[model samples]
Target chain A: MKTRYTYGGDEHIYVEIDDEMSLDAFFIALSLSNMVREANIPGVTEILPANASFEVRFDPDVIAPDAMMEKIKAFEHQAEAQEKRLDTRIIEIPVYYEDPWTHETLMRFRERHQDPTGSDLDYAARINGYETVADFIEAHHSQPWFVSMVGFVSGLPFLYQLVERDKQLEVPKYLRPRTDTPKLTVGYGGCFSCIYSVRGAGGYQMFGITPMPIYDPEQKISYLKDFMAFFKPGDIVKWKPIDRAEYDRITQAVEDGTYTPRIAEVAFDLDAFNDDMTGFNAKLMEALNDA
Target chain B: MTLEIIKPGLATTIQDLGRPGYFHLGIPEGGAMDRLAFRAANLLVGNDEGAAGLEAVFMGPEIKFGAEMSVAVTGAEMPMFLDGEPRETWTSFTVKPGQVLSFGFLKTGARIYIAISGGIDTPPALGSRSTYPIGALGGFEGRAIAAGDVIPVGDGSVVAEGRVVPDALRRRPGSPAELRVLTGLYWHRLTEKSQKAFFEDDWVVAPEADRMGYRFRGGQPMEFVDRPQPFGAGSDPSNIVDGCYSYGSIQVPGGLEPIVLHRDAVSGGGYFTLGAVISADMDLIGQLQPNTPVKFKRVEMDEALAARAERKTMISEIRQSLS
Candidate 1:
């Protein structure tokens, strides 16, 4: 795929690896971003890695835009030639599907949704060929998702399904963005799903709410003591659908600083995955189970 | 030392040179909008150029100094009052204990930077003392300073009053500010007519102006080049697959008004950005008043870089003059 490099003023350079978002496209973009970070190119102040794209904010005074572009091209080539295995973590996040909080939120913003007559879950379920919301929920948590990008807001992780492209769930964002989304709400838009790290403006359709806090600036939660943001790029997430009782229990545990997300170390090999998607996925699951 | 907030003006927040290197985490480099004014205030008060200071919008806050300390105010032409007596802005003055420094209605510009001899000693969040309320991090209690809030101040024992920023050094937007724009990013998405109209038209700053972005209206509704929507991009003609948003990136959602993302905006979104205001000209956006007319002047990369250098040189000149 041809890459597009465009300037964002004098300070930033946006690099689009592909117009379409896919795991394969994202892997290459991540690889290049990783290489650029490792190089520690002077004047490169901030390197943001998005799905199928990346941006670098730099000091033009120190490193000219042309020079930065040349180095990025070299790094991209080098990264493409390197092995495609990435050391990552698989974390289990407990989600309460069709939770009351998000339901109320989505209901409040129905005027902005594609189907004002139905709930976000119902609309998403109908569009994706699910007989009922329950079936759609099953399809959502049936497989793990890859954390392709973490942004738009503090600690928000955009998840792309681990399954093949044909099996991916596609949903359009709201006709207009909602001014308020419940924090930790599980939101789906386009081919990706996201957990709202903070309560703020969002366009994604609300599906559920997770008790697990992805971001804690206060570090009140013990597990998040290391960093404010929990999810990182390249991390894999396994969703565990829980009832209200379990959600409450986890929420209590989270407040008590006793709850810790179940995380497992895993190494992803793109070559193996491309060769046999089913076989590699089973192995990846095995790795998570082993941990 | 300590300072008590007697009155929290409209959208008063603590800011510095901003925290960088965390855009990947979606935290913006949120600091002073007018970097030169911020630096001038700090330099006037013998504090570090990047020291945390109060950035007040149209209205200014009433801060009561606990003890005699040197302070300076810069940016925005406003009437300053020291315990009901008129005081000059852009010139450092000594405020005694129980003497509350305040301001009247702003005549021109939008934001003003108030630098205390000792900078506001707010705890740094992700390496910045800038108050970014959305993330609920930084500044006093990770939010805007409220009235009666007691804020900690660093050692400002080194005090030399009456250091003034010359009138010419004060940067204020003209009646119709000519903001330079570097057309790139998703500029190709806009029709040629729309592109030309964007440059030729005069836009007014909407009331939606804030630290997040400056929304411009009054321009002809932009028309996008029609094409089948991309796989993941939203249905809107102005929508693209969510991409990283740069500081000063101008996005026109649904081919309507352009909103230039500022220092405190989200790092990425799905809106189609036509281009970005050159970094050198971004500071001007902060001082823009509501209903102020502005024209987007297109500039090439070389010209943008030259403008950046010129801004840097001017800052250096200020530093040298102050020193």
Candidate 2:
């Protein structure tokens, strides 16, 4: 994998580890970006790692761009020699599939969608070769997903499914972006899934909504007391499809400040994961359920 | 002290140097659009350069002061009125206990920064007083200042009158503003003709300009080189795999209007960015009025760094002169 280092103006250095999306690409970016961060390099203000690329915002006044680029290059070399094990967290996200909130939002923005005749879930299911929406929902939560990137808005996680490439669910975004996307709306675009953390403009194909607070500035929820944004890069998420009753119960728990997201910590090795995807995912789920 | 809002002008919000170090969380380093103007206004009023101030766009809000304090207006060349009496902008003057301050229609620029003797005392979210309305994160109640809102202010002890920012030092948009851009990031995606036309064409600022970004139109439609879309890259030729977006990054959606992502920009998106406006030129973009003619000047890395240095020197000059 050739990492292309591109300069963004004077302060930002964008390093694209790969052109396309894959676990391999994300691992390289995450590992190298981590190395760069741990180096405690002066002038490196922000290190933002994405799905396949990473951005380093630096103060050129303190560290010259060419010199900073050299440091990053050296860090990349060190990252190659280092072990690719990431101590990450696996969290259970309860998704209310085909929820009424997203249903109403998708209908309202139907004219901006590729298929105005049916719901976003229907179009995505039909296009992905699923006979029924039930089968599509099963395929969605059948395996875990990686929080490859966290952005677009505060605390929003762009999730990439951990299933084999052939089984990956791919869907196109809306033809035109909707002016409003319900907060915590489960959305799909391209090959990634995302939960809208805030109610704002979005073009992703709506599938469902989550009752749990995706972002709370007040840190109202117990699990999120330490940080306002719950999901971070390197997080593993297992989507659990729930009914309306379970959604209401969880929503109430959230209001009472007693809700804690189901999470388990684990050390992930990309090489080990590549060898036996299903077997490793089962073990990860076991740990999560046990927790 | 408090400033009681009477007539909240267009999109007025509290802003400071902004909360940095939060871009990774998808939260932008949002602050005043015109940072130099905001800083100078604060300095003129004996406040810290990064103090929280009101960023009024296009128009100005009518505010009644609870106590006597010094005030200064900077950025756009708009006529200021203190209780229906004309007052000089860019000059620090004291307001009486109940004197109302207002502004007339803008003459040249889009935004005006108002700095009081003491900074706005709005509670910060994530270490910034800057308003990010999309996230409802900061500023007065996480939104724009409205009528009947009595926003608190820090205590002002020193009242220095006759402090003025000279016209030569103030930032003013030239006739047909020229913005220096270091074009690189996905410039190769566009056809050779499109690349050449991007610099040659004269563009106009679209009405869609805001704190998030400035959209420019009137340029010829861009054409992309023929290439099969990559995996996870949306169907559009303008689409790339979702990636990080930096401040001042310019992304042309649908090969139509070019939007320059600003301080409050979404950190990552799927669209391809042509390049970024140099950091030095970013402050000037915030002052551009809609329909204002503009030219994009292509610059290299060496020149971009030189401009950055030059701007730093200019700021230092402003600081020294004010002190």
Candidate 3:
């Protein structure tokens, strides 16, 4: 269930397991690691697991790297002893793709997409069909997906990949061509799913709509319902769909406090600087000086 | 005490140290453009170095004090007066109740700082009193000071005795200043010719500069690896991963001109940075006005730290001498 490895004298540990465990477990583990205590050892900043490798960063002045490596190895051995110990839950989110602005935008997008060959298209195209796009979205409503980053922009939750697509969509560049890009824009660039935080000009292509606002200003919290987004580097993500009414109901529940939002955090090894890179300290110092 | 603004001048506002640790929430680290002058002006009075001080751009405000208060003015060499009497520059002075403090146009720097012993009284927003016009948050309802705005001053304590910084200690006004910088995120993506030009050529601070960022001319646009990452306003990886915002970030886009980020810039960006103006040189950058030619100087981290330490010591010594 658990494994540990050493990379360049530092501890890189990971846990091997089935995919059903909740992401909250990982969030808690990272938060605890940030407290910097391991078998009475102190000064650790983070223990981050990305791409199946967990890295621990600590103040080298207080603790030796090798000692931490030993602790990680011991911890992994203990984790290996436990199996099927954590409970996992699957959550489904319903998304509605009905908004006047979205409808108008979809029309324009379909027109642009059909540019090369002059083929008359209608909104009734099924799934990938220009026409059935909305219907396909509604049919897949209340589908459960994995959570990536919570409150990415105020309240927008970036979901993990929707693995069901037979073909992967082409992603755009990470950076939009310009600033002042408008809202309700959908762009695929990185490995994860991303939504705009607010209305501004953006390069993301227009996609379907979700009526619920990701961020709730008054509560100062985002309601990222059942989606766990807890996948480690190698974990699998399955995305399912739900209907329009279900989307409205879930959003209403979130807005009305019937649904609780979970907090998801990621930890990375800040101390593990890329020594090969020049001016590394300069960049760190820049942040420090400002601090 | 209070001061009735005769004219708000061009984009005047009260600023302090800034709102830190809120970048995660998409808040800009809004503060004074020239922190040195901001702190210096505060030190001239009895206020702590970070006390809220008036940031006056060229052509400062005309004001009448409602009560006798000790105030110190620094930054731009704008001819200042109280009751029409010529006042010394870079020093503290007493303005009698009902006396008017007016300033002529700045001849050198882009901004002038005016600090009151009591400091300006304004409600803090998002952990700071700095104004962010884009979000309409902080200082004076998140807006620039207007002609009719009455600024409140804190309760008085010690009187401010005028003390002039010696010619040897003061940075010579109008002297050409060099800005030291370090390479940033996308420094490698630039063309070899463009990169060489960046280090060798001189750039002029453009008129479009503000607290948010400074626009510079004369350097060819820096290139990035084929595509930029997610960038946006406010704190979100969507923006960062999306390549929307990059701090201390620079961007050339399609233009020959490059924009260097400053204090009030958004927390994230997606630009190819040739280099960022080092923290120590921020004050110098703040002092530059439109048309001011500046040469970029590269420095080691040690040199930057040393310069920063020296600046801190010099300011402290000056404060001690005055006290």
Put down candidate 2 lDDT per residue, A1-291, tens digits, no spaces. Answer: 778887888889999887778877888888899989999999999999999899999999999989999889887766666666789999999999999989999889888888999999898899899999999999999899999999988889999998888898887777656779999999998888999999987878998988988787766578777888988888999999999999999999989887888889987888899899999999999999777
Query: Per-model TM-score of chain A alone?
Result: 0.95, 0.94, 0.42
lDDT per prediction? Answer: 0.88, 0.88, 0.52
Q: What lDDT tens digits, residue by residue, belong to model 1 across residues A188-275?
A: 8888899999998887889999999988888878987899988888898989899999999999998887887787888888777778
Supply candidate 3's per-residue lDDT for A229.
22
Candidate 2 residues B78-158, lDDT tens each?
A: 999999999998888999889999888889888899999889998989998899888788899889999999999999765
CAPRI classification of candidate 2: medium
**Top lDDT: which candidate number?**
2
Worst 10 residues of 3 chain B by lDDT: B230-239
Ranking the candidates on DockQ from highest down gives 1, 2, 3
Residue-level error in angstroms, candidate 2, position A141: 1.7
Docking class of 3: incorrect
lDDT value, residue A14 of candidate 1: 91
Q: Which numbered prediction scores highest in DockQ against the true structure?
A: 1
In candidate 3, what are the lDDT values of residues A19-138, reduced to their tens digit?
A: 112233333333333333445567554343321122354444355545655665555434433332222323322233444454454444342332213211122222234345545444
Q: What is the C-alpha RMSD of each candidate to the true structure, in Å?
A: 1.9, 1.9, 11.7
TM-score of each: 0.96, 0.95, 0.63
